[model samples]
Target: MSKATVYFGIILLLAVVIYFSLGSNFHNSTTSDLNFGTFSMKIPRYWKKIEFDGIDSYIGGITNETDSLTFDYGWYSYNLSYENREKQLFATDTINGKIALITKPKEVGNGTLGIYIEEAYKKNRFNFLGKNILDEQIVFEIFKSIRFKDSDTTLNSKSFGFTDKITPYSGRSLFYTHCASCHHRNKNLFGPAFASINELDFKKWIIDTTNLGLTGMAKFGIRYHQKAFKKLLMDNDIEKLIEYSKVST
Candidate 1:
């Protein structure tokens, strides 16, 4: 072969290699990892973070034109009646040993759909929702890439919990994390309605549930939620939680 032909062939091979390498990066460049102090997840760069309101008001969420992902460190409950259950396609699986549920409308390109994850081992939960998201595999890949920070140091040190920076938003997360399992804002659950408590005694109840300041059924909360009163909460955190409870309903 002529040297000129040999040079041209080598250059052509290098061009092919470079093209493939750049193509791989271009695909990856469309997504980036979003950090939320305790965990991180891969999402499209076009997705913008927003705070949710109302009952889910404490949740930190992100969304684009068609898809949304919301998550928080706490308990989340989802229920569907038997008839409606038959109308949907749903499956349960595990993520890092934690149970997860992915639900979609019966037919593709149909109704609302979501993924609910219960991270029992870590006392945290997260979920994603999309409307008419034609590609379930793409959403699954995003959920699969979620990475939880290996330690609690960041959760404790940062604004992850109720703190001086507490807002109605963060307070809702705190309530869901610690209080929602037992207490409800309006009607009674395992505990009395938050609406019944006056401000002064409510502060006392949160600060020292085992103390003499509490009486009757209110004291019952202590045995079930000792860690809430004892662990990680500051005076301001308690105050913020109290503020949230009043407006929570």
Candidate 2:
């Protein structure tokens, strides 16, 4: 109860407050914060994006999504099928975060080999007109859209949709059924690299190529692969394609 003791206690309490208030600073920075393109986000400071072999590439930071955090997650990939290389993928997990639920192909090793995207919202909450947020439940939207130059791809081709469930085989089946007629899995037979695309571009690409409900391409996409193309494909699918495109021969 002495004055000296009271003063010391105040100092201790102040220090504690300062430390706790710094909780958020401890937060992990999302990939967007970095300059890395929308393709391989969450890219680390240790790594850099470069045109390695004329394709989207990352070198450094945690590579494998499943592998324990270590050096740069190898290389994250973009669906550039024409570019022949090894298993390059997005290091989804943090150099320090939870173990990613989705484990990539063993060919990709244990690292979070998929692109980490939370679905482009129709309207971002905190960022209403570019605002910020502390409220988790108050959902915002992203009034954003990606359109492609070519008109042969679809949204399904984009990072699978927000949460698609198309497996590799099914995706391939769907692609072959709908895309192979015009495109080739391993070469630029019809269009560009099916792999080099980012999810947003991929989706937009699908819409452009297929023509959804309009004219040109959709005739087949809507006729046969419409249901699965729209439903089964999701953002994760984009992640898969990003990787799949790279392994192409």
Best by TM-score: 1
lDDT, model 1, position 240: 65
- Model 1 ranges with Cα > 4 A deviation: 1-3, 27-30, 53-57, 71-83, 119-125, 149-249
| lDDT string, candidate 2, 159-188, tens digits | 222222313233443354345556666667
| lDDT score for residue 176 of model 1 | 54
State the number of backbone clashes in model 1. 0
In the predicted model 1, the residue pairs found to clash are none
Q: TM-score of every model?
A: 0.49, 0.29
lDDT of 1 by residue, 77-181 (tens): 342222145446665444433334556667776754665655533555566566676776667667655656652221221111212221222455555555655
Candidate 1: worst-modelled 10 consecutive residues by lDDT: 157-166
Clashes of 2: 61
